[model samples]
Target chain A: MILQKISKQGKGELAFAGSLFLLGIFVAWDTSKMVIPQGSSIVSPQTFPYMVAAFTSLVGLVLISDVLRGRLGTPDGAEPGDPFIAPSYKTMAILMAAIGLHVILLEIAGYVVSATICFFGVSFAFGSRKYLKDFAVSLIFALTVYFSFTKGLNINLPAGFFEGVFGK
Target chain B: MGNSFSMLMDGFQTAFTPTNLMFGLLGTFLGTLVGVLPGIGPALAIGLLLPICLTVNPTSALIMFAAIYYGAMYGGSTTSILLNTPGESGSVITALEGNKMAKAGRAGAALATAAIGSFVAGTIATLLLAFGAPALADLALTIQPAGYLALIILAFATVGTLLGESRIRGLVALAVGLVIGLVGADLQSGALRLTFGNLNAIDGIETVTVIVAIFALGEALYLASRHTLVNVEVLTMSGKAWMTREDFKRSWKPWLRGTAIGFPLGVIPAGGSEVPTFLSYGVEKAISKNKDEFGKGAIEGVAGPEAANNANAAGVLVPMLALGLPTSATAAVVLVAFQSFNIQPGPMLFQTNPEIVWGLIASLFIGNTLLLVLNLPLIRFWVLLLKIPSHYLYAGITTFALLGAYALNNSTFDLQVALVVGFIGYLFRRFGVPITPLIIGVILGPLAELYFKRALQISQGDWHILIAGPFPKIIYSILLLVIIGPMVWNFKKKFANKK
Candidate 1:
């Protein structure tokens, strides 16, 4: 059983190594675009990025080596132990949609109105079936924040087009 | 001593104002409630409250937020003792002995001792802060880039100690966060580093956004993806929420010793609470007559570690307030909050804002009292929090987290960043990369780089200054040993085993 657990751990390390390699390649390619000036003792803008890229590449190679040596592995077992396991793809999809809608509507709907809608939808997505409880709480949270920030703290949170509604 | 007393009195006068008191109670109460929930602690609570703080009076809001900061540390111990869920990283030590006591049906004793021990340690640590903070500030005025660099190095070494099981993975996590933290516009040159042509990135990734993503949202994502959780049975109090006379007799020494050890260690930039907590536990175990009771269900183990953790938290403030050094992740966040208020927290802060500093220190005392009062009688009620279904709890967490991140800049780009970081955090967690180092790296990495450059500029490209003087030489020597000693020790052990 112990050996089995160790073996399972190895697979997870392999995937991490692959991800690190990809990240390294992207960083290296992105950083290589910078051209150094003719006469300056100062490091160029890309210097730090290139250094990080090189380090990342080295680490990635180390990780791949460890994986090859079967040192790293996956979690011991693949099983859902809790009733509230990983959220379903449907739930993630709904959450993503709600957030996207909120962002798109933020400028037009204004901070208060858009945030309220965002919270309400997200609350429902979380299986908060008590609509009244969710709405009341979400609105209080959003509006209290709005007044506190915009009025009390004097922060210039976007009032959006519906600034007329709150008279900001 | 006389001046310190007067300062305390003046501090109390400011702290005791009706508005400040109300804010303190509200902050502590909320802090405790949030801290009771697994994985949400003072740092997130403060981050969530930071935008709101921008709307309120800076001193009052900061006072309340600071109250919540330590208050959550106290509250975190409760959950660790009763539910084995460490509400914050510091409380993880508490769970080692605390949960054992709970399973042994001594949950009441464990909870009471932890609460009372935290109170004693917190109160004494406050006194230390009140008296020693000024002197420390005076000393910190002498700090140059050389000292600051050493301090950051010491702080970085904490990553190795706190990271579980695999130090290599922890270092990797720290490196990743440091790289990410450097992804915005350069401070000195005003040139962009790795924003990839995004205008919003010029302002840099908000510390709150990165923190909320990494610890709170990322934690949620990791737990979700894990598809597994320890289902501990909810422990109920079998008796009064007070320690027995015998229990008190045994616990008092450990509490005092822990306070003595933890307070000073916590003042050192590298001497984070975790080190002192372990040290306290070791001391208590070594000296206690009831050593066998440890790991089985020792009250002193819970009492000592919990006290040490709280004391160290209070001790962390000495450097943070006096020298602008953040000893822990929560301390780092608090440092960010101070910066956000345009109040640089260094030696000058004492001269410039005595009331604000003293009032905060005084409020820590009041907040601890309020927390003890709220928690002791309400122990049973808090246990009900453990019954909160994971689904509803995590859902609420996700909502607040998303809302909090959005409010940081009101930019959707941050929300997307949160989602991406959340996923990456989940992957990191799945791969066993500890997240605390990531937090340390993100917060400290930028500051270290800036300081390195600034100091170099001051000395005109003098690299020797980085390791100049007796103090800096000692720091480099220590750093060298820390980096190299482990590898050699491992090699020796392996060779010996082979033989």
Candidate 2:
């Protein structure tokens, strides 16, 4: 069981390296497709991208070898969060959903509504189980941001459903 | 020298006005508020402050932005000393001694030294900036495109090699950023490089979107998934907030030494505060009479690293203000702010817009003084910020991040772009790719390419032109040394160990 967990962790790291290698190939492939015009400045636009592609792909290979030798990368751990606590993927899923909902509802429902939903979902993901209280707090926070930013700071966050409620 | 002093006086007039002072005060206050938090960083704080540019005039906003920058630095030290959870590598050195002091019931003393050390370092560094910038700009005026290309190469090499946990990871981050930066059109040839046929891609991926997403949104999601259990404990102050005379005597020298070590590093393209702070700590530990007390609650340990951190922040401005080269993340953000105001911050800035240049520099000084006042005398009030629940804090960050990104252009596409970048940011955190090099690459990548092309254009396709100039030659040599220097040192140390 312990070995299985260790392998899972190693697999995650290897996948990260794989993604980086693929990204490099994509950059190189995409750069090759760009049509070079005649009499363009002494350097073609492809020069820097090619360098970047080679560097990324090469470093990605180095990382894979390092990981294979049991040299795992160190994540940023200098925060107040508990490192011992097993990360909750359920919470991650909820938060991802929250962000997606916020984006989709932003134009349809308005800044305050979408932000309130996002705020509430985020609070829930963070383990604030007081549902009614959380919703109230999220609503108030969203409304406060909407008024302060839209009226006070002149940033026109979309007022979709609540347009002209206060007669802007 | 005399001319700069007079220009600074003119700047004092602009910073001291009632409206600007209010904005400056607000900037520092908010800077500390967010910076004191463990997860949030100054880049995200600046993103949250973007809408203020729309509300106020450019000069006032610039003043506010400078104040916010200083405030965040001061606030970061506070968290290091109190919680021992450094938000960035720059504060990691401080956590070693300052947190020990806090645990030993010297929280107040630790906080005091950090505040006073920042003041001393900030004042001295600003004075140097006032005098040194014009001289550097004078020199920069003579540099060619090849020289600029060499300097940019030097920055890329140092940022890639010097920062984060591993050299390869840092370099990979930089390369990925270069790829992302090319997502727009080719400005010179008018050819689409990687836009995938979207016309809006002509203007390029929005930097504000990338910054807000990567730092705030990415951080928020990373925190949510990785951290569900609380582990922070803010130590209550047990003694007088003021440092004793003995503490003062021990601290003053380290402050000076730290300032001396930090400013030059900050002015150079290797611009992160992490190196200077570590060097300052090492110097203090090596020279201390209380060598046995090094790991324990030693005042010099706290004083030196904190001062180095501040002086290094100030040192970043020298390159930024003079040559329009951003040596650090804060400098990059400030350059973006200046660009937003349609004010180019190159050598011509002093000639074209003296009011804004001097005023911005002077306001930075005022902001430092304001930071000292806010953190030192009323520290008790600020310590309460640590009690804010992680959930609410991150939630607020997410809301503000999305708002800031959307507000920048009122475009939904940017929000989607932010979400995509945010996911990438989460993967980066999980895998340990440093964000700073990535940011530096994204913002400066296009500029580096432009300089490379121009230098080649000048020699009419002769690659040797890159090695022709004295400045380019010197800078390229430094780049070579930066890449090779550490490996040689490590190898020598390993050999000594084997012996």
Return the TM-score for each candidate structure.
Answer: 0.85, 0.94
Query: Candidate 2: which stretches are off by over 4 Å?
Result: A1-6, A35-39, A78-87, B488-499
- Clash count list over all predictions: 8, 0
Off by over 4 Å in 1: A1-9, A21-58, A73-168, B1-6, B160-162, B229-232, B484-499
Which candidate number would show the highest DockQ if scored against the true structure?
2
TM-score of 1: 0.85
Report the Cα lDDT for residue A124, model 1.
60
On residues A92-112, what C-alpha lDDT tens digit does candidate 2 reach at each position? Answer: 889888888999999999999
For candidate 1, the chain B TM-score comes to: 0.92
**Candidate 2 CAPRI-style tier:** medium
For all candidates in order, state the fraction of native interface contacts they contain.
0.12, 0.75
Please provide, for model 1 over B1-499, each residue's C-alpha lDDT reduced to its tens digit, 9 standing for 90 to 100: 7887888799899989899899898888777777777777667767766676665687788878777887778678877877777766567668878989988888888988999999999999988988898998887777788677777766777564344335556566666776777777766566665678899987778878877777766666555444344455677779878888999998998889889988887787543565677667777878888878887888888888888888888898898899887777778788888888888888889889888888888989999899888888887777788787664566557656766787767788888787777766766766656666777777777777766766676778777787877777777777777676456435322322231
Predicted structure with the largest TM-score when compared to the true one: 2
- Tens digit per residue, CA lDDT, model 2, B1-499: 7898999999999889999999999999988887888766666667667667657888898899989888888888888888887777678878878999999999989999999999999999988888989889988999998898888888888887777667878787788788788888777987677788877776888877888888887777778777544748888887567799999999999999999988999999874877788779878989999998888989999999888988888898898889888867777888888888889788888888888888889998999998887778767777888777777878888888888888877887788888988988887887778888877888789888888888888889899988896788899888888988657435422322231
